[model samples]
Target: MEQIIANGLYLGAQYALIALGLTLIFSLMNVLNFAHGQMYVFGGFVTYTVVVQLGLPFVVGLFASALALAVMGAAIEKFLFAPVVRRSKRDESTMLLAAGVAFFLDAVILLFFGEKQRGVPKVVNGVFNWDMRIIMPYDRILIGVLAVLLIVAFIVFMNYSRSGRAMRALAQDRTAAQLMGVDVSRYSMLGFALGAMLAGLVGGLLVTITGVNLGMGGPTSIKAFLMIMIGGAGVISGAIAGGFILGMMESVGLTVLSAYGDITYLAIFASLMVFLAVRPQGLMGKPWG
Candidate 1:
């Protein structure tokens, strides 16, 4: 049970990291970026190519993966999202555009990578043994530590940095932010890039733990969506809360009913429904005024 709880916390950390990025983008742009998952996949591929294929150092590969995805995120914001913002269309249009990008990217990846599950080489190796009875991978511990560091960095950036303040302003009210000379479009692009970079970092971390493949993106996106929904659309802290809760539920569910493992989704959906019934605006979300 202790080991299970540790594993759950590790998984929750990853989910929280991914969900944080998604939640930030959704809050600022009001768009569920379907292509975000592809960026995650791309990050893994970047690291794989750099370290595994090209024989580069792990840290180099990691940074390269993050930088590449950050550039892609910037491009996505500028070319795809910026046009939609310029047209001032409904929120649905942005979702549609994201879906279209998702489909296109998936097809491209399928054509190139085919269907293969490949694992990233572990950067750190060991096992933590407690009382000479329980053992767990040090890599998972590293993941949890990294997640905490990233979350702290995100919070600090959002609260202290100029660009972060602009992002917060835009998230609250775009028109008002623009009137205050915040350069809304620029800030939006920055937010998207930041979000994508975080996703890429998570992707790199995930590859070390779970391997890489094309199909993983879709399921990850679904999980991220659930996190966002359960966390509340616009709340940063909500993402972490929802992710930990969902991760614990999933881990506990799997342990208790390993044979009926597929029922986790039903449990998640029920929880969401219950949460909505009681707190329509989500745990941290502001009530409709």
Candidate 2:
């Protein structure tokens, strides 16, 4: 149980970061970015390239990943999503565009990063074993701590910073925000960029532990969607709650059901379905129209 809890907390911290990005984008633009997972993979590859291929420090690679993804996200919002949202009457148009962008990103990743799994050297050595009950890698501990710190920073920013306040305003009520003198376009783009940056940062951090692969994008995106749904689609706190909930479920299922083959996920999905049937709006979300 100690091991399970430790593993769950560690995984939850990182997973929450991923969900935060997705939820932020959804809250701001009402656009589900299918390409988010691809962006994460791209960040991992960027980090791998910088650290492994270029012999740069891990810190440099991490920042590079964040910066690159931020630029890409902002450009995508400016050129693709914004225009589509402006011109289209139906919401499905943005969804289709998101799907198309996901495919395009997949192709781009395959072409540039190839199909191999890429990993980095351990950022820290040794394991922390406490009373032979909880054993965790030092690198994992560091990653978890960093993830938590980043999350705290993000919360602070959203609650305190000018851009963050603007983004939150936009998310709450677009028309009201605009009427209050908020530049909707600029803030929307900024919010999207920040979300993408978080994804890239988490990817870079996790590369040392899970490695980077071209095929993980779809699964990652699916997991992100699940987190958002579990917590409530457009709520930040809900996203965090959903991420930790999923992480705990994953940890327990993986550990307890190790002897049961792949039934772990089957059980999980079934449970989630039942839960959603009971509370469709999630723990903190408003009911859908």
Candidate 3:
């Protein structure tokens, strides 16, 4: 039980960060960024290259991943999404564009990084065992703590920073924010970049544990969608709640259903479907008109 709780908390922290990015983009532009998972994969590859191929420190690689993804995200917003949003008459076009970008990134990752799984050396060695009931690797503990710190930092920024406030205003009401002298376009791009940065950061952090591969993107995106769906679409708090809930469910299912093999995920999805049928708007979402 103790090990399960520890595992759930670790996974939840990382999952929450991933969901936060996706939710931010949705709240701001109403665009479901299918490329988000690709962005994460791209970040992982960048870190792997820096740390493994280029012999850089893990910290440097992590920052490089975040910065690279941030630039890519801002460019995508400026060049692809923003133009399509302005010129296209339907939201479907943006969705298609996002899908195209996801495919493009997948190709790019495959070409540059190859299909082989890649991982960084552990930043720390050894395990932390408490009463033989809670055994966790030190590296996982480090990553988990860092993930929590990043989440807290994100919360602080959203509440106190100028850019964060501007983005929040834009997300809350674009027309009203514009009327209040907020630069909608600028903030929108910034928000997208921030979202991508969070995804990249998590990708880098998890590379040591999960050993990223080209095929991980789609499944990661699906998990993220499940999280947002469970919590409430476009709600920040909802994303966090959904992530933790899903994490705990996964931990419990993995432990209790080990004899059943892959049925754990099937059970989880079935449960989620039932739950969503009862509350389609999610835990904190308002009913769609």
Rate residue 67 of model 3 by lDDT: 99
RMSD of each: 1.7, 0.9, 1.0
lDDT of each: 0.84, 0.93, 0.92
In candidate 1, which residue ranges exceed 4 Å CA deviation?
132-134, 259-261
lDDT, model 2, position 55? 94
Q: What would the per-residue lDDT of candidate 2 be over residues 1-289, giving only the tens digit for each residue?
A: 9999999999999889999999999999999989888888989999999999999999999999999999989999999999999999998799999999889988998898899999989999999999999999999999999999999999999999999899989988999999999999999999999999999999999999999899999899999999888999989999899989989999999989999798877987898899999999988888871
Q: What is the lDDT of residue 107 in candidate 1?
A: 87
Clashing pairs in 3: none
lDDT of 1 by residue, 107-190 (tens): 877886676886777778998899765578888888789888888999999999999999999999889999999998888888
Model 3 TM-score (2 dp): 0.98
User: Cα RMSD for candidate 3?
Assistant: 1.0
Better of 1 and 2 by TM-score: 2
> Where is model 3 more than 4 Å wrong at Cα?
none
Q: What is the TM-score of each candidate against the true structure?
A: 0.95, 0.98, 0.98
Backbone clash count for every predicted candidate, in the order shown: 0, 0, 0
